[model samples]
Target: MDEMMPHSHLPAVGVADDEPSLAGVIAEDVAAWCRRLSSTLLEETGESLLGKLRAEADILRTLVDGEGSVVDGQPQAPPYRDRKGRLRNQTNPVTSARNPVAPPMALVGSDGESEFSVVLPIQYQGPPKTLHGGYVSVLLDETMWHAVRTALDGISFTRELTVTYERPVPLGVPLTVRGRVTSTDGRKTFAEGEVLAGGEVCARASGLWIAPRR
Candidate 1:
């Protein structure tokens, strides 16, 4: 068990909590507990405790306000919506507490390459102590397309996405995500991405992005 005692030396999730970013961070923290509750229920919760959790969840659901559309100028994209300064944006299901797939928190960072990192937690597990394949695919696809928004002009949509799992990505670890432009043919943009854990590649993806006529 100690071998999987978590990568104790990993850096903390790096995100600033400015006035604009506060809400997103709060949501991330809350989502984390949701993940914990889910996994715990699967492992050790009994019927009584499960009922209590359901009641609590229902209460929270009632409190939730409906989501509105993105503002006039903000980029409207799939997988997540772009917010001015929020890391855990309410508009983004990947980082939103209200969404089932969101991790507790993910830290976005760059290393002189066209890539970012989202710190994952145990809540996003599939195989024991490993990240789920579906989440991995989305992470690569969304991140790659998001990266494309910067590299190309006009709104781009994911025409195709291909993901290859290199290794088992550990839960509760920082994963480096990168998407880079390889070339372009007319309105088509070609990009490639990879996810790395502890400096080792875990997944790779190639995507085709297109600018559809309005």
Candidate 2:
């Protein structure tokens, strides 16, 4: 009978013993033990630990390439692709709009007190050539929220917002909205905002924001 050829690359599995070869059985047991241990660590430590492990695994990957050794785990990559269509390279979208007199006002300042401005075009008219009252209200709301954030500490959400239009905001000119926090009481904060054009206040607003309960 012909003798079995030894695998040069792979380590021998069987051990010389009177009983059945223990190398294969021991390796399988060790692998299962490692899997169970990793699962337990993940369950106890949560996702942060997993993220660190993934980063470390990536660093170790260079050592194993071209060695005919394949790690059983998948490569860690971001869920979304980048603009260039490469794996793991991605960017968050810009949150601010080009124009301020619109829904979903864009954030404009690094500090809590933020100022945003917009030029009223002829197309955004209420009557003949004046800006719409609704558009003015949107600016007031955004300004008030920014003010509230500036005055208070921690995160806050708007509770009640009220605006009073003083005069008609003219079109074909730039309108500036300034927001600042007036006062705060525990979780509740009070804020004031105003829309100005040509150094005159066209609209004014006051609002309350409540900090989320822990």
Candidate 3:
């Protein structure tokens, strides 16, 4: 019961083409087919391999993409790295990699603080290899609303969060999430987070954000 759920900083930006485009290689090939169907939906046991993964998601949902195949102007902005922050969030599904139910995130420090890393495969398990206390409280309520929207870049909304599990988060390793902003009043804002691994600290969080009125 790794009392789960989970940033600070805003100075690690980078990404000016240099490479990867073609819609970032088709959104990392659909986030690597959603990390290989989230690790084969947690180690496929049977049912004819889960009916061939629902018949390959119904033949990849007919190769979606329409509306004149978008691309008429802007709205593609894809850049997300956290360790050496190079951020951007085209309709976040946690850094949407074509939103394959998102497990994507690579945000890193900047301004008020933020950081990321997650490895919750095994279908985001729970009680066994851990992680799944409401998905660690929505990963500490979306990293305390992206640490007050990347320190007042705008938008925020997690009016409360308070996780506190001190251990047991080990489903395939890597786990480090952080958030910041420990103050602010009018329109309320206050955040905190933690969920380390090898370096200890299992879980910790604190939040209450707002920021509506413009």
Best by lDDT: 3
**Predictions in order: lDDT:** 0.60, 0.55, 0.66
Q: What C-alpha root-mean-square deviation, in Å, does candidate 1 show against the real structure?
A: 11.8
Rank ordering of all candidates by lDDT, starting from the highest:
3, 1, 2
Arrange candidates, best TM-score first: 1, 2, 3
Clashing pairs in model 2, backbone N/Cα/C closer than 3 A: none
Better of 1 and 2 by TM-score: 1
**Candidate 1 lDDT tens digits, 1-214:** 1121111111123334442333343344345546667766655567877786887576455423212322232322112223343333233445444444555234343321255667766567799999889888877765666566666555676777888898998877778878777787888878889989999999999977776666
Which stretches in model 2 have alpha-carbon errors above 4 Å? Answer: 1-95, 98-112
Model 1 pairs in collision: none
Per-residue alpha-carbon lDDT of candidate 2 for residues 93-204, written as tens digits (9 for 90 to 100): 1112211212223346535576777665554578777878977776776566666655555657667777888999987677778887777788877878888899899988
By lDDT, the better pick of 1 and 3 is: 3
- Tell me the tens digit of each residue's lDDT in model 3 across 126-193: 88878777777777677667767777866566667878888777777888888889899888889898
